[model samples]
Target chain A: MALGEVFLIPTVLQDDETALESLPINIINTVRNCQVIFTENERTTRRHLKKMDRNIVIDNFQWFTIGKIEDSILDTFSQQLQLGKNVAIVSEAGCPGIADPGQFLIAEAQKINAKIHPLVGPSSILLALMASGMNGQNFHFMGYLPVDTTERKNAIRKIESMSINDNCTFIFIETPYRNVPLVKDIISNTKPSTRLCIAANITAASENIRTKSIQDWKKEDLNYLHKQPTIFLLDGGRQYAPKSHY
Target chain B: MALGEVFLIPTVLQDDETALESLPINIINTVRNCQVIFTENERTTRRHLKKMDRNIVIDNFQWFTIGKIEDSILDTFSQQLQLGKNVAIVSEAGCPGIADPGQFLIAEAQKINAKIHPLVGPSSILLALMASGMNGQNFHFMGYLPVDTTERKNAIRKIESMSINDNCTFIFIETPYRNVPLVKDIISNTKPSTRLCIAANITAASENIRTKSIQDWKKEDLNYLHKQPTIFLLDGGRQYAPKSHY
Candidate 1:
């Protein structure tokens, strides 16, 4: 009973295995039957499924490339409506259509009357946002910025300038390998009085949820940066994570 | 041996009952000796415990009140923390310290360095926010707005004027009795093209999750206005939760 035929599943994997295994069974079936699996990293997804003992046949799933990703999504979304069925989109990690590369797909889905169902699960992004408690009122997810030193620095500078008290929040993520460098850039480049939180290896055994001032951070090196997967959340001068600085 | 002297139990009757039963065997007598329960709704909490068929005499149990709420919290936090003991704050209908009455206690606990643990459970606020799709990236929970028309209208106006985009989200609950008036005001006052989403009775039977453009909604009177326990999540804009002109 495939009420919806096409599906988009995220390819990124989280550090937790047991929780990942608890994905909705219907979603797993949809992912298995979909003719095309538009994924950021098809190889990695397949490897993860294999590790989870899910023997899914990936022969028919087309690995989505940047050039064809948009068209494939648009086509599937259109066809699903024509057939009167729903299409699901999954992100490489966390919930789909968020910071993942599926916004264009979701926006298109909305433009056409296609239903977009986002299932709630382990979202490191949301975890960091909720845990940060700095600007939960009105915030924005700017996604990941360019890794080029100058470009990244410029982007951080813009975010820094935009920070206002209790107005809005800006959330972004960084690659695990580049976490250290990104932290260094954030600590040095952002305003000294600004408060920031780093949620590392979120929902894992070694999770580190700490919000602190930029000035205090600059005085020391967070040794854990080099040892784990992490995400950085900064709100110019608002608040820290649950930990007390005093 | 008791890891910590004080126990922070949830408001759930099941939790209190289990604790009451477990202590009678005297194996967990340490838990019985340190039973100064710091509860928010003292009257209701005590009643729930009594209903659980427990005759446990609680001479030491300090059922806190709304007025004593502040003092009791500070004293409990300081005492438990200094003694290197953990005190459990019986959670209410949902997670503690997020847009609920227990926040002051949690904040004071944090200030004094007392360990605060939040267990996973039903949170109407988070549930409604997620179901609304009005942008969870940044959101503000102003509790329940005043029932008076002027104050309600003013609150609505303040939130309605916020920059509408996928960046900021404003969430506030309305009195079930005044839901219709609120909706009417929205239609007449805000932009006709703004988008508004109402999630009613979230996570309960007869749940309603619908987002309609103000222009589209003006055609009918929402009959469910009288339904209590409804949540209004408005993302100001012509696209998200919009204002309609009838």
Candidate 2:
């Protein structure tokens, strides 16, 4: 008997055709091949699946939430795999299991010796890195910084220093609402010479990616970026001269 | 007039429908809109673009090779953007500007304040992380480890320790031919309990992603994975119970 497999599916970051059109046709076929799914949110998962394939019967497959995969849920998930029922795991946005809650089930699937296939899709971190004009050979995705104001500032300084010392790019995200404060903290804490890349609303119509030095950014009016989903990148290696230097 | 923008285009990792299908349909439109393209390899970029749209006249657009972005080429790239000529940048494989040579051009675009759009596509690193079942929130991509035996072993040990100390996943890649030695080094140097995921031929026909403890992996025969492009992940957090623990 074939062991049930696990498929890691990536969903669109924004709800639009532009983002939707990025997905492969295989995604719909992969969805159809699965009998059970573990998703970050069932409602959004169904909506995305329907958008991919309106003909897909929403009620035919069993759905489970992966908010917090307790031991019991883990047991059932692994059991289903052992029973030869392929399962799909979808995150609320973007790719699952990266800065998301899909890793727990993936770990369980590995333990049970289930085949795992991670389909392709947009990853905001990767997208942000792609346009940052920073070091790509070596980089660190810090996920999110410490929320405490003092800790966050200290982290910014440390990250800046590390970026210089290692010649590595540092990427971090902020809560949408706290985006303004985070940017302010970055500007205040980092060196004036350090290069910063602000990538906001990635893959959206208003998507913007710009690189500037901390000092140059202080002179600009950037309040419009507040509350937008943004990814920050800092590369202190002077790989490329920032606008100020130019 | 709005300045011409830079689009960081992502290409297929493997030359197959499964790999090519992951790219967005908008890529063709993006290609049509661009008047100039800076690519790592001009021939391969032409092949990939032709694969996406055969009707795309390969000679219609000016091609620039980013083998070594001298000051002269950098000036030309930025000048083209400043003149309102949209340009596309394509890497040899996967997404450009991420572990590829496209960042220099992106940096030049940034210096000139050109809008940058990183379209969605398959990234082997992100794909590997998605399927690694390891700590994804805090991870470091070391890119490539040292080639020397002693330095490589020391690097592996340090990476393993860092994974344990920070509960972070450590990802690194190896040259295709050196894959076997790297795997041997990993199994011999890492702790018996440290979890390592070997993801090979991502988005290809023989794609495989599996995680196991050093002890468990030592018992298996995996010589077949040699000479294949692969991504290795090490996470010592024990985020979930290993197969032995289960």
Candidate 3:
């Protein structure tokens, strides 16, 4: 018996076509062939499909809403695969499995020995890291900081310490509305010379990416980041000269 | 005077169009508009550009080879930007500025206040992580481990310890020819129950992504990984039950 294959698809970061264009042509063909679709938000997935190909009949496929992974949900997936139904996991933004509920579906697929395919697309975290001009050799992506003020401060301190000690770049994102406060915390809590890269609006037309010292950032106007999706990066370690003799 | 712009472009992971197709269409247009290009490897960049668009007059554009960073190279970049020439940085594989020499160029651009644009494409590290079904929220990409036998063992131990202590996924790559030995070291050193995800030949037709326990992997033949580009992931931490009381 043939086992059902699971495709890990990627979506655009913003609502524009520029980010969507990054997807390979085969992804659209893959969408056309899938029997069942699992996504965080069905409406956005439909919209993305429509943009990919206006000819795609959105109602022809079975759509499943991926919520918290429960045992029943795992069973449902297994039964579908047992029936040889192809499954595609889509996310609301960027790659499905990263920082989303899609990983639960992937974990189930892995346990059952299903063939998994990961398609490529825009990832805001990687894009931000690529443009940040910071240390990329070693880096940490801390999805989001704690919501509590004290805990968030402590987390920021820990990130700073790690960046300096490991010679690594630390990356973290925040809730859209909390961008300003997070920047403020980062600027105030870290060392004066710590390098900070604030990448906002990602693939959008208003994209802003700049790397500056904490001291320099403190002197700039930050009104541009209001209510925007952003990724923050810090490289606190002192720059090593090209070579040093032992 | 308007400053020159710098574009960070991604290349195909394999010598095929499947990975290249993930790049946005604007990347070709960006290439057409740029007067100068700085690439890690000029031959590969030329081949990629030709593949992106056959009609592109490759001779019309000035090409610069990115060598080790030094004062003269930095001065050349500044001079080009000062002349208001749009520049593009191309990598041999994946996105430039990440695990490539392009980051140094980007850093120089940022220093001169040049506009930087990061286009979207396939990144094997991120793609592997997205498919690993492991913890994506907290992860580290350690470019490569030490080559010495004792140091390599210690590094593997430390990675496992970090995974268990921080609940973070540890990712690293090895030289293509050394993959088999690295796997052996990982299996012999880590706990039997530690989960390891080996993703090899990503974005290629022969791509393989599997997440298995060290014990299970030890039982299987790993001769397939010889001389292949692979991403290794260790999630030694216990899988947290879906719910945990605060």
Candidate 4:
């Protein structure tokens, strides 16, 4: 029997119906076709599934919570594929296998040669980069910084320097509550001429994406980002460089 | 008056109705609201606009072709924004401002403080990374490798070393016709254990995405990639290293 396909479904970044506008219509069909689901958070996934299609019987599918992708879960996942049971993987928010633990299961599926389809949806990283007006051709997604203050500062400096040297944009995220601290560290550590983009509440009614040099950013009141879901982008290349040096 | 909002519209990777399934339903509304359009290719954008909504009168909106974001285009874009006329920017394919010249115009819009809304759509780079099952938390998009044979080989080696050292996934693209040649270079230059993903014709009926070690890739026939839009990803990190070694 042919191995069952794996579908990577992306969830809304915000918990509002309006946030669902970022997802394509076909995702509903794919989700309906899957008999098994591996989700980051079962509760949120259930709610999201219900939002996608109210008629979907949540209890009819076998659900697996993806915490660490342990050996037992892999075994069960592989077994389901062997039995030709289509499976879907959903993240807590945004696209799976990106800045999330879903990649482990995806890697396993690739090893088993299962067909994997990644559906389009809201991705803060991608959305931020597209609106930043920075170098998108060459960019790096660094996920998050260290929780330790000192280590995080070091990371910011390192990424800023890397961006300047490579003419590449560096993207990173921080805990919603720590957004202000992260921005502070960024402002204090980076050069005055370095360009920074703060994209907050993407896809929501309060969405704001602004790019400015570090010196210019110092004049703004950033208290609005205190607890907002935000993605920060740093571009250290010379101002208005037609193309990236690399 | 408030500065005009700029919409970053993403087009289908493949020119098929099925490919349109990846786009969100709301994009049609945003496209309709815009009174001015700056597109990479006018003919294709006209066809795409008609496809999005048959009732859309193409000549109703003022269209500007974006070859290079020169002074003339920037002047027109800024003038329209100053007039509070909403504008949309469309790429030839995929998301604008990504691996495309749309960023230049976006950068100009940023300077003018225009609200930029980046709509969700098909992006080969993101889709490839998600399906590749590589280290998505930390990945670098290098755009394209050097076209020169010797420089391209050197650049591949450099990126391979960078990936190994940083445990970061490196993504790059090539002209469709040169896909095989770039793969050949990657195979010959990288270590046998390096993981590579070849994603072609993404979001289309003939889509193919596969990930394998360099050694395993050597055994497959890759001639099918000729003239097929493709993205290549390389991860030199040790096999299945749980998290990227930043």
Give the least accurate 10-residue stretch of model 2 chain A, judged by summed lDDT: A237-246
List runs of model 4 lying over 4 Å from the truth: A241-246, B241-246
Please give the distance, in angstroms, between residue B206's alpha carbon in candidate 2 and its true position after superposition.
0.6
Cα lDDT tens digits, model 1, B55-162, are 756555655543344454566555655665555454444334444445445445434434333322334555455445455545556566667778777777777787
lDDT of 3 by residue, B18-103 (tens): 66656667789889999999888898889889988999999898888886766666678878889999998888889888887778
In terms of lDDT, model 1 sits at 0.54
| lDDT (C-alpha) at residue A98 in model 3 | 82
Q: Give lDDT: candidate 2, residue B79.
A: 79
lDDT, candidate 3, at B68: 73
User: Tens digit of lDDT per residue, candidate 2, span B81-173?
Assistant: 878899999989999888886888887778778889998888889999999888889999988999999999999989988888988999999
**Tens-digit lDDT track of model 4 for B46-136:** 9998888899899989989988656777788899999999999999999998988888889899998999999999899999999999998
TM-score of 3: 0.97
TM-score of chain B of each: 0.70, 0.95, 0.96, 0.96
Query: Against the correct fold, how does model 1 do in TM-score?
Result: 0.63
Candidate number with the higher DockQ (1 or 3): 3
Q: Runs in model 3 with CA error above 4 Å?
A: A240-246, B243-246
lDDT of model 3, residue A129: 90
The DockQ values of the predictions, listed in order, are 0.10, 0.59, 0.58, 0.60
Shift in Å, residue A59, candidate 1? 10
Off by over 4 Å in 2: A241-246, B241-246
> In candidate 1 chain A, where is summed lDDT lowest over 10 consecutive residues?
A237-246
Cα-based lDDT for every prediction = 0.54, 0.87, 0.86, 0.90
